[model samples]
Target: MAEVSAEARIEAPAEKVWAKLTDFSVYGEWNATHTSFPKGPPASLEVGGQFEENMKLMGFPAEVTWTVEDLADTRTLAIRGKGPMGVNVGTRYTLTADGDATTVRVDGEFTGAAVSLMAGKLKDSATAALNESLRKLAGLVT
Candidate 1:
């Protein structure tokens, strides 16, 4: 398995960060890996909700069918998905409010046979993507 994470301190409240984080309509605008939502974002963001996303990583395109694993308003969101070549993907977003600013962390995991072949490269690419995504997200909210 390959694991990656990135963190950023945004100059905005958790509520504002969470609003942009969960608002799937604008997800692709800041999410580096996101290409598009195949059927649009989930209608509602309850646990067990499902959505299809088209993504690109390391210059390769993939489609993932994701199931929401956890959710907490203005605090956390987690999802797991099945991706190309039997790879399993998991992502979690965490937010901690500190006065008027928010600290956001994104954690990711990749498993299955495919990951073993290029774990190092995947980790580098994913970590970079997460960092870039956070920067974009921060730009949007702050």
Candidate 2:
């Protein structure tokens, strides 16, 4: 199992940040690697909601059909994705309200055959990419 976590304090309310992040239909707006994608159907935050997300990762077409594993409004959102590579990845977003700013934490876990081989080399890159994305998102919201 390989895990990567990144946290950032966005100069926006927790609810506001959560709204923007959970808006899977518009992730391409602030997420650099996920750009050039179109909005999709309305997907809710819950324990069993399933949806498809198409984006670019490392210049490749990265698409995943994920299911919501857990959710807590303005605090946490967890999801799991399964694929041929046996990739079982999970993303957790935690929010903390600080006056008018919200500290958002985006954590991810990858467990499977593909990840086992290159876990060490990928961790730093994943963290950097996620942190960079959070910075971009902060700029978009604030």
Candidate 3:
């Protein structure tokens, strides 16, 4: 398995950041891994709700079906997904409000027989993507 995380302190409130995060219609503009949502983003964000996402990871494109596993109004959201080649992926977005600013962290994991074969490279690539995503997100929300 490979794990990667990135954090950013944005000059925006949690509610504003949360809105941009869940606004999937514009996700591809900021999310580094995003390709498209073939079936569109979920109409609502709730535990057990599922969505499909086309993504490019480590330069390979894949379609993943993800289920919302956790939620907390403007604080946290976590999803678990199944991708091609038997890959299991998990992503968690945590937001901490500090006055008018919000600190957000994106943590992700990839696990599968295939992951073990290139864990180091995958980790490096994923880490880069996470940081880039955070930068873009901050730009949009803050």
Candidate 4:
């Protein structure tokens, strides 16, 4: 299994950051890993909602079918998905409001027979991607 996480403090209110985070229409503009959504983002975000996303991981293109596992308005959102090669992945986004600033953290996990073979490299790539995603999110929202 491989896991990765990253955090960033954006100089923007939680509401502002949350708006941009949940707005999938602009995700491609700020999310470095996002490629496209074949059927589009979920109409509503809630536990059990499903969405398909095209992603680029470690320079390799892949598609995932994701299901919302948890959510809390402006506070937390998590999704679990299955990708190619029997890989299972999960990502959790957490938002903590601090006065006018928001602390955003992303936690990711990969588990599957394939993960153990490239755990180190996958961790490095995923960590960088998470950090880059956060930086882009801050740039777009703040």
> Candidate 2: which stretches are off by over 4 Å?
33-39
Provide the lDDT at 37 for model 3. Answer: 90
Per-residue lDDT tens digits for candidate 1, residues 1-142, read: 9999999999999999999998888999999999998887888898998999999999999999999999999999999999999999999999999999999999999999999999999999999999999999999999
Off by over 4 Å in 3: none
lDDT of 3 by residue, 52-127 (tens): 9999988999999999999999999999999998999999999999999999999999999999999999999999
- Distance (Å) between predicted and true CA of 40, model 2? 2.5
TM-score of every model? 0.99, 0.86, 0.98, 0.98
Best by TM-score: 1
Ten consecutive residues with minimal summed lDDT in candidate 4?
A: 37-46
Tens-digit lDDT string for candidate 4 (108-138): 9999999999999999999999999999999
Q: Can you give the lDDT of residue 104 in candidate 2?
A: 88
Q: Model 1 off-target regions past 4 Å?
A: none
Better of 1 and 2 by TM-score: 1
lDDT of 4: 0.94
Between candidates 2 and 4, the one scoring higher on TM-score is 4
Candidate 1 Cα lDDT to native: 0.97
